[model samples]
Target chain A: MSAESITLEELDATERFLLAIADDEFVTGQRFAEWVTVGPTMEEDNVLSSLAQDEMGHARLWYELIDHGRDLDTVGYNRRPSERRNSILLETEHTDFGDTIVINFLYDTAETLVLEAVAETADDAVGSRATKVLEEERYHLEHATQWLERLVSTDEGRRRVTASFERLLPRSADLFAFDAAVGTAPSTAGILSRPTDELRAAWRETVEETISSLPLEVSADALEAAVSEPVTNGRAGEHTDALTALLDSIHAEGLPADHPASGYHA
Target chain B: MKLEERIAAGQLIESGDELTDEYRELLCGIIQFTANSEFMGAFAESEWIPRAPSYQRKLALIAKNQDEIGHAQMQYQLAEDLGRDREQMLTSLLAGENGFGNAFHYPADEWIDIGLLAWMLDGAAMQLQHSLMKTSYGPYARIMKRVCREEEFHIRHGEHIVREYATGSREKQERLQAGVDRWWSRAVMFFGLSDSRSEKSERMDELGIKPKTNDELRQQYFDTYVPKLRNYGIDIPDENLYYDEETEQWEYTPPDWEEFNRIVTEGGPETQARLDRRRTAFEETAWVRDALEAYDGTTANRFANNITA
Candidate 1:
């Protein structure tokens, strides 16, 4: 339904659902942008840079849909960690290029799946937005897939990337664990029709299948261990200290009082 | 027509074979320096991406620095097409055996320095690059066209930030002033030596690689930026700086060439630090590149990968 056609409950649920997606994109983009000028090669650096900016652009699009009267920068940078809604998988510090690659794969894969769910069941406005976001996400997945193959081709690359997968994949259990955030309101309001568990299962299958092709081994047992762990999630605004540090660092320089981006922190 | 005849007729040289050895050497040097500068420049300011004052600022900073890297990629490819090796250029850059702009050799001490970098340094580069859009080499001129287009955004973004700071609180204005004081001399010498003191300008002008002499570009940079900074209530570092109405020239205290040569030939404050960062990153990621090379560069191999997501 269009904005005029949709009931208030639907609008509220839709905004809640998309806010989580936007937060994920924004945080992921911030992490990705950290790769600027430091990627393995100039070509790869260019690609990562493009990916970073694309994510920020995606975040802005989602924010625009739900910001009410706030500007993008306010909605993006001014949110406290406790208020943010993103997977804990994405909030970790990127200590290696391998970490970036693994997270890129996991994040883009989960995003594509969930966005597909949104596109399939959401109102026309959101469905079209999801469709648009997926168009850009298609390249991101391709990048992830190609890099995963090449990175795993070597012993060192495989070991390092596997280590990243072990650490990061477990955190990804929170991707579809959004029930605590909006509490099935989106699903109930029909803003999202796919059952959460079904989405989680599909995501795990795709990720496992992708890893199965490579020589590298990620402990599937560990991923499942985290998945079934009770309420270990970021969707309910429970984030790791990593997100706290990220917020502090970004706000460290301190925006000027009159600066347009200066939020409550100012 | 002969290469010289084509150049003399103001024609673009599209092919490498049409060049004399001197022309090729000069063109190669110019392109190499340009490509190296882009990479190094991006490196110098790249760390600020995550720490930018705001989300919009962060995005803008990333796009700006990212453009420098993209320009490097394009220019390196252009250099390769002109008989230079991209890998060797990068290797030399990390090895401390290459030349790039003087501005990048220094650190951006404060966030305000980033503003000055994009505002003044990029502004100065754009002055020279806008002129290079008319360069005699076809590939380089074409690259400059796209490069200048993107550079316009950097300068505009910088100007916006600088304007805000200029109109902002007392503390913000003071920081902006300090950044200008630190960067002003470097920006002045950004054009390198004046035509009379430089050996390469006349030759470059003769070959049409760089049509504008050092003084000309510097003058243009001064004309645009001097008033802008002063209007913003920031101080210019040089007291002797003035426009010569009689001679139709901008005059300023010339940068200490001895200091310029020392920093350029020896190294600047951040030269070793930034280069080490690149070297370490390059060494660490050598495996990824080596692995791809093993498969004949399957890094971007589209359909050949086994993963299906």
Candidate 2:
């Protein structure tokens, strides 16, 4: 099951999986970057900006792996929204800080579970990259969780967090809805040592446990109801208006023709 | 020895303890202003992060803004050591009761403006920061070393973007020219007014806090940038901009001092909007800070009890 034994077909599937994750990171980083100057505090602004940069860097790493003969920008920027595989949860705009925290909490928790599973994969390249990503995700999860805990301590805070969860959780189910071709191949071939379902279960359990431990009035049934439906399965290339708008906005100012083909050095 | 004597002897003022009351106030004011400039500069640039045309530009812009915030943190921390509270300074800034650099008070509407900001505005800041690297105040001077280092990258990034545009299509070249026209006067005014005009400059020079006079730094900035701009086929906006062989200086049209005064006093096009944004952010995040303070108090008390037990 070593990476050396991974067939071209299997590697192709693995590349698809990596693409989905990279798209998620890129879109999420773009969303979080909206808070650069306007975050609730200067310190929090720095924190969120740093997290955005980290996520973008992670996306760059994944993109580089699947770049083949193309450059990172070619892979990342040239693709249309319909071709992107990021979860709808990450594409949605965050108008409220509460919504941002909820998305951060849910996405980081899921990301941590998936990365942990990937880190244990038989593919050395995948495992090493996942391990590095997990190292950064540790701080991301801690930052989200700490804020989630504090945010739920007040009635107003709790209300906002609950509302965000209610609006976002259904969309988040797409985080686990991997593409059929990519999703089943790696696990079936043993390149991905852990199945995607197991990662989803772990994510669900951790999220439930963490939320329950908070002083908020969120019920177990409510959590179940929130994620019961897979709303716009982004892993299968199904997305919403948000993704299209985000892409359009990113390219509103025409793409530069003279940029470095590969990636930014510094 | 007196403060003047210490400055004359090339002694570094190592701590707040060494500062006389007047010197302490002056140093704190200067540092606070610099910190506010960093904060505002970051805020001004933040608008373009989402709109950066390329991923490379996006990453560079974010890194540059992050550096600005980091510099602001160091400056605020330095000011705090001199008896200015970080919160109070931030509040004062948001309330428009304090001033930052005039260059940041204007709006940066176009991508070309961002390029100019990184090149021209940051280049101007580099002039001042480089001079302050030998500032008599130890903490400020030490922090300037780091700030100046990062600024080197930022200025290069700016120049890279400008070069890209300068060598681009007719439209891009036009945009670069227009951006330069808009930013030229502001960039010149970035060094504050002339030496004879400001008593503060004379006091700062005497204290070794400001090594170069405003006119001298402006001349240095012009000497470096003017020829560079002409080489790129970009016109210097000022018709009167010329080099004087006799004075060994570059003489430019004097900036509108009246406008500069108004802008630094929170009368610029985007000053009110920027301040309101900061104020709104502060107000919205008040609850989070309160919760953190409460959590810290409880944790401290628990640790204290464990020791007593």
Candidate 3:
């Protein structure tokens, strides 16, 4: 049902959900952007790159909706490191475009499903915005899915992407962690419509479908363990070291008032 | 010549044609135009690398921009294969002695502008590139084929932006329409001087290296894009534009060729700023490139097959 009022509880849930998705996009998107100047080949680089901006655009959309009443630039630019919440997957950086593809594929798959679910919400504002965001995510998912398939089809591509996946899989579930700051239940909070376990299960199922062809070391029990205890809980505002550094960098424009170097000293 | 052989041929002159001073100058102009345009295009596109709205868009824009740089690098290498060194080409481009496409000189005013330029402006380039598909220069033709394939996305990207604006909120639609209106003249001028009886065109066409005249390519661009604009409910900005029934081509009031020439030759409005950005960025990233350049054997030791080795 449509929300009658912007309850603080609902706002918290909405904020949490937006942070999770936005963090995924911000981290992964910037990593992908770095490849703009450096990709293995021109064609492959160009092919993979469209994803970077798509993710960032999606982040902006989520920010707009979640922080609806606030100034966008401030929300994006001035948030503290502790206030930021992006997943570890996007924060990891490397020179290899293949690795970049692998991370994007994983994150995009997780995000597409999350956003798809969000698109069905009863709230007109959330649903309308989610619908628009989903369109861009669809494009990113296609690019990631194609590359994932291509990587798995070739023995060389398979071995490379597989190795990268194994390294990243442990941390994949961090994308769905519930934050106290953003509240708990979707009905009460306005973020997720389902329980945490349900969202985790759904996220797991989506990841399984995409990696079904690949010889991923991700077994059913491992996925269960992952759903229960993540390698990192990003949604709870816990991030990897690299992600912390990234948050600081991304939030360079929006450092908070409490920060000693917050405003206009320069 | 074998295609593989030509990919690295560096320089080519007909067997009977000795390299004369005038011939050298003609070749220089062609090389300068190709090299400067590629670099200029790269520089222009990279501006949005940091600010692209999403991860996917950021990656795509960067990759597209990278392709332009790679194309520039290849062209520079090709020029180096001729008498000019990389330094000379870089110096000339920096000094404004060389010229890139006029469209590259304009700042990407907004996200949609980038999409529009990629779509319409790059779409116009495909007309010229298609004509060079069978050019005498084997490598340039092959490169164009690869570039053209990737360019299909640019057109799609542009179309998507136009679609979003057409269907979106009035504010967004207006911003996009205004964007299209702002870009319409530049897009028209992008195909180059329409009425110029320039000797360069006659020579390039006669050489079988660049087959289409500026007018021919401009007409082709109109025929292809005008309908696309109309389909998206976009205004053409030109009431005079129409089809010639007898000639079976588009006919329109030609752009101001003199202004077109002046902007490209002297620097487009954003040229200096764009180049400065590029130069600054390159300088900022000097350590990284330097690290790669200076590496003895550590990169290989760390990641043996890291970058498609």
The top-ranked prediction according to DockQ is 1
Give the clashing pairs for model 1.
Answer: none
lDDT of 2 by residue, B59-170 (tens): 8888888889879978987887788777778878888898888888899887878899999999998999999999999889999999999999999999998998899978
lDDT of 3 at B250: 79
RMSD of 1: 4.4
Candidate 1's C-alpha lDDT?
0.82
**Residue A238 displacement (Å), model 1:** 1.7
TM-scores, all models, native as reference: 0.92, 0.90, 0.57
lDDT of 1 at A79: 74
In Å, residue A16's CA in model 2 sits off its true spot by 1.7
Off by over 4 Å in 1: A1-11, A254-266, B197-199, B297-309
A161-221: candidate 3 lDDT, tens digit per residue: 6666666667676766655435565535645555656776877777777777664554565
**Which candidate comes out best when scored by TM-score?**
1
The sequence of per-residue lDDT tens digits that candidate 1 reaches over residues A46-69 is: 778888899999998898898776
Candidate 2 per-residue lDDT, tens place, A117-139, comes to 67776477778889999988888
Range of the 10 consecutive residues with the lowest summed lDDT in candidate 3 chain B: B300-309
